[model samples]
Target chain A: MLYIDSISKGIVIDHIRAGAGFSIFKYLDLDKADFTVALIINAPSKKLGKKDLIKIENKIDLDLAMLGFIDPNITVNIIEGEKIVEKINLSLPRRVEGIIECKNPRCVTSMERNIVHKFVLMDEKDGVYKCEYCDQIYSWEG
Target chain B: MLQGKHLIDPEDFSIEELGSILELAEDMLNNQAKFKDVCNGQILGTLFYEPSTRTRFSFEAAMIRLGGRVIGFAEPGSSSVMKGESIPDTIRTVASYVDIIAMRHPKEGAPKYASYYSPIPIINAGDGGHQHPTQMLTDLFTIKEVKGKLSNLTIGLCGDLKFGRTVHSLIKAMSRYENVKFLLISPNELQIPEYIRTEILANKDIPFTEVERLEDVIDSLDILYMTRVQKERFFNEADYIRLKDSYILDKEKLKLAKDDLSILHPFPRVNEISYEIDEDPRACYFDQLKYGMYVRMALIAKLLGVA
Candidate 1:
């Protein structure tokens, strides 16, 4: 029974995995924003037992697909004039760059400092991203 | 269809393309004189950023045997690379003089990166623990030539499976065939990575088992692929010493294996296989070494569209 005011013009990133809201907040650099942003953690939901939500009172260019890649269970709500305008569903991103790193130490990106780390989705069901240069499988968690 | 193709990974080609290369390799092996001057007056540029005697010699021999001349540097110090030239610049310049470029670089994916810029076909000789498609081609050639077929065999891959690039590529290539079972023998610290186990084996529904000892599974193998526990791959000297001698294939261990079990190693083997085992007829490493040259011959000519 937690309540927060809905935004008239903004985006609400919903259905974030419980305890992952702060990471998404920091990942998006929300702290540097001039507009009001609220990160709600451990919110009860029907789809997920507990989830995290981020309400931003500004229309910013967010890559919802990338957010989906970070956690596929995520949903994004675009609001205008206190009404839901659009809902974006996220899925595994086919290509990602600079957001994550290849864990393989022998990867070419590990050796060449100037190279950009890029990965392409190899398996959607498994959420596998392989390094573009060295073909090393990249995982977010060790 | 292989002409002007850059071999970055074994999976880069379809099974039919690989079969074509294998077919050409057999043709060249049986009738060397018939295709002796296939690449006559053509040139092969070998750009070795890392020091490699066996791989460099094999490519050079393959080109020379096909009546092609060799040009290029063995090490970076001798080339313009010493001037801090980028890989793209060097490959672009080298492509102008040679029909195809075979490069071994210290940085992984360097050849793949170079292939993006070079006009000629780029053969990756060895890229830092990354895909060495040519070596895998040589390995497949060895297995197919000796075993009389490539399908329906139990392959035991032993030692340093984690860091052995040859083993990684070979596993990916062999998993394409039917009825291929993998007995992945390695210490707990050197087990095959989860990506490989899950992606290559589990995804393909290829049967495989992980074990610590070679002796426990040697008798059941149709082919035993041995790899060195390289000191360079170890994080510390203590772990290197502790696991280095764990699986030496002496005569005692060989007795436990099948008589027809073909022993293959991507050489300069460092004490993994005992020198005494060199006398055994099943010891195919030396002949396998010869097959490396033939396979490279087939690969080079096919890439150049000369064969």
Candidate 2:
């Protein structure tokens, strides 16, 4: 039942799975940002009955591809002057570099001192990303 | 062109390239003393993200026998990786110090990522349940060395096909040869993956048959490849106990096999094959290990463009 007052600008990230909004917050480093940010957890939604929402009150740069990985169902609405300016529908990124650690213990990245873990989005509907080297798939849990 | 190639999958190399490497392997096998110092003064880096003493030592032994020095860590906890360095950054830094790298990671395609950012050649030692191209190389070399041909044979692959990375690689490698038929024997739970059947075998129209029992067709095989069925691969202790002994190769099973049939295994087996069978001339598992080293030496030399 908690909602923020209408903002003049910035973005509203919608449809995040309940409680996962905090992961997005950390992933995007929003806590360190200068923008005014509000995280609404477990909010009722017509589309997603219980979901999370993030409202940012500053025009900050974002990587939509990365957002897709965090939660593909998320909808990003960019607002300017109290009106919607742009809406980015999430699409899984083709390749993600250095953003997430591969959970696979056998991955070469686990041994090498300075290598980055990279994954390519193979199946978006299934939320599956394949390791670029080992070809193991990583799927998002519902 | 070979400088940045990542050997994540066996299919990464075309048949022509495999043949070229095989030919180089043959030369190195023949003139072992002549090329013993081919890699002298160069360093081969072994970065094992997972524990595999067998594979790590094979690569290390190959480098040492070829007069090359070896460096790098076998475990992740001992390295800077424990501190949170990424895979690409680690490979980039290692590529600066070594001429070549052989990496074993539990995640499939980890070596491929390293290859992308690495300045040197990246050889995949093994990647989870996906591919073990070097093991395939060793297997192919051993088969050709013992049987004298890569074709016109019925090769029996027995046990744990579902999770056996070596079986998957061997099948892909052998499928490239002429008149090769496979008799895949495993429990229903351990059948080969659909991708291996559809993408590599059946799609290519290679003749193969699948069966649940090994003793049923043990007599007809020219080459018997035995893999251990680990207790961990089973769902429960009861299932492991039920299937474990059935897959074991004793003298009774070998009695049915052809006298000249060559038996191969990527070793460290746990009771999959009886010791009595080791006395038989047909047991070539130990010899396969030796051939493994030679094949690796050949691979290193060829990849370095010095063969």
Candidate 3:
């Protein structure tokens, strides 16, 4: 059995879908972090058969919008003095920027320089996000 | 109050603001010389990245008639964009030399992107199949002129509803008023977009019905907004040939329509509208084109804070 020690103070991103940890890590820019960071893939969960988890030893502002967009089922646990201080349940962000890139070739984002790819939550029930620029409907599942 | 603002969508302005512009346009139409020098020292930059005839010319005529000088390229090939300049760079450079701009780009949201970097007002002339706010203004102005009001009328939108950005904008803009019902006439392959059907009409509780035949709804409409139903939109030629004539507004179709039914079409219309119907008293399309120019004149003057 492989065991990993938990951090005394930092953020533990938990319940990421089994194969989605790497993307979350890259999105959070934790791959380039100098501090202690552990990306544990396929950790056994009672809720999910298997899930991904990220333990960080440094305090960083986790982008809620990104975490919400990627998977709202994920939870963010803030630890302090070896105890969970605050727990955050993710929900769809009303607006997202610089997270999902628009795949529409005819969108202005394709030709413009230094433009932020923005999407607004259009249908919360269906988890639908629409590109703010081109009005392209993006399904959350894909 | 609308000084130095960008018009990226039809909903960008409040109902009152649109009314003010239309009012100014009406006033300008009645007394052209009184508003001739309103934009005397101002300059308008017309940056058309794509090829366009009517929109480009109308904007130029609007600025010129208002005594405002015009500058900029008609196509990207003639400008620094051919040398690989970014939209921001182009907008930044052009905005410095002009008081306001009317721009047309093939990419959706290109003008919206330019508005972020542009110091002056950026009027979206036409942006892909997404938006054409000025065209919406022209449409609304024409409806008000010929029909005498923007509300309490059954507006029939025919032809290529799926790809008709102008029709979509007109629907959204007209929805702001009271008692505006829509009869969307299009083939099954080219019906109104699902999002528009749900988000705009259904969500707003606006009354709208989808029909395949134009002749069936022509008699009931107070105004008929016609758009080209292109043959290329169909998947197969058989489908195109079978469904094409159903949308064509011929003399037979006009015979069933109301005598006071004001017809409006954004110009360069194809065979969807029969040329024979052009001389009809109800045909206000040519007058609509002139109203487009007058609406643009009011738009430029309002955006420049000269109105």
lDDT of 1 by residue, B203-281 (tens): 7899999999998999999999999897876779999999998888999999999989999999879899999999999
Better of 2 and 3 by DockQ: 3
Candidate 2: deviation at residue B258, Å? 1.8
Q: Mind giving the per-residue lDDT tens digits that candidate 3 earns over A26-109?
A: 988887999999999999999999999999998998888789888888999999998999999888889989988888777898
The Cα error of candidate 2 at residue B233, in Å, is: 5.4
TM-score of chain B of each: 0.96, 0.94, 0.95
Every model's DockQ, to 2 decimals? 0.48, 0.31, 0.64
Report how far residue B247 has shifted in candidate 2, in Å.
Answer: 0.8
Off by over 4 Å in 1: A1-10, A17-46, A49-59, A79-85, A122-128
Can you write out model 2's per-residue Cα lDDT over B94-203, one digit (the tens) per residue?
A: 98899999998776667776677788889989877668899998898889889988989999999989778899999998998999999999998888976577657886
lDDT of 2 by residue, A1-109 (tens): 5757877998999889888999898887988988688988999988988999899999878888778777778999999998889888886778888877777555555
Cα displacement (Å) at residue B238, model 3: 9.5
Local distance difference test scores for all models? 0.88, 0.83, 0.89
| Deviation in Å, model 1, residue B60 alpha carbon | 1.2
Q: How would you class the docking of model 3? A: medium
